[model samples]
Target: MTDEFAPTRFSHVKAGENGWRSDGLRDFFLYRDLGVAEATEGKVICHLVKANMAPEKGTGWHRHEAHFQIVIMTKGWARFMYGDQDTLVSAGDCVHQRPGIVHYLYDYSPDMEYLEIVSPADFKTVEMPAPAEVPPFTPWS
Candidate 1:
């Protein structure tokens, strides 16, 4: 019997030529949206999202339909807003999100870098919910 070999899904993504990819912000923001490699149908899909958010530039309110998110702060600080709950996660902190739950981030500092791991990769690719416009710099007050 011969063993079959399967290739790994990912490799390190280098930063842009300028050493930073602008996210239309002054500071710097970049990400790698791992598509189908992390999408495991009928069971769980994982999105290995590594994001570097500029100061005061963060994501909007969005919710998952049949997926859950496990957000981990690997670099700086970020405030995660889930409905009426305000959670501040720094490096080494982890946040879990349930399906149908609305959430977003704000008050991200210049040193903010985080990773979002989504499970059941059931995120809506076409009709993704847009994040609500919340007052910037006031996610956790």
Candidate 2:
């Protein structure tokens, strides 16, 4: 593969959380593609998730290695916690984070929804330093 990688198409849709569920939340996983695995090289791994927050619950802190995550809130509102800072992200707003950063979400509105994208394609290769104490939501802080 050259420096350029094939683009994957993603359509906004509703989905449910996988493996682990949080706060009695029925989450969703919209779409994901990492260049069909073999074709991915030095490229970004794209993921799209759609879910709604019911009340005062939020995702837990989590850390990533070799991946930069960019969360785009298409609808609703949410408060993102990265390190010592907390930022409220609403519809049409996006949050980006570098690798190995400790981050989490708090005070998610009842109608919060977002899409998370990871760069470097090899995101799956990252190993969690420790099993996230909280299921569904993993908090590093």
Per candidate, the number of residue pairs that clash is 6, 7
For residues 24-134, write the lDDT of model 2, one tens digit per residue: 222432243323233344455554444443433454556767556788887777666666676678999977777787766555554555766666655643223323332
Best by lDDT: 1
What TM-score would each prediction reach against the true structure? 0.57, 0.55
lDDT of every model, 2 decimals: 0.56, 0.53
Candidate 1 local lDDT, 1-141, one digit each (tens): 233323324444444422434442123356544343333332444333334544454555666665666778877777777776777889888887776777766666556666666655445522236444455584332
Poorly placed runs, candidate 2 (over 4 Å) = 1-43, 52-57, 120-141
Per-residue error at 8 for model 1, in Å?
9.1
Worst window of 10 by summed lDDT in candidate 2 = 132-141
Q: Candidate 1: which stretches are off by over 4 Å? A: 1-28, 33-57, 125-141
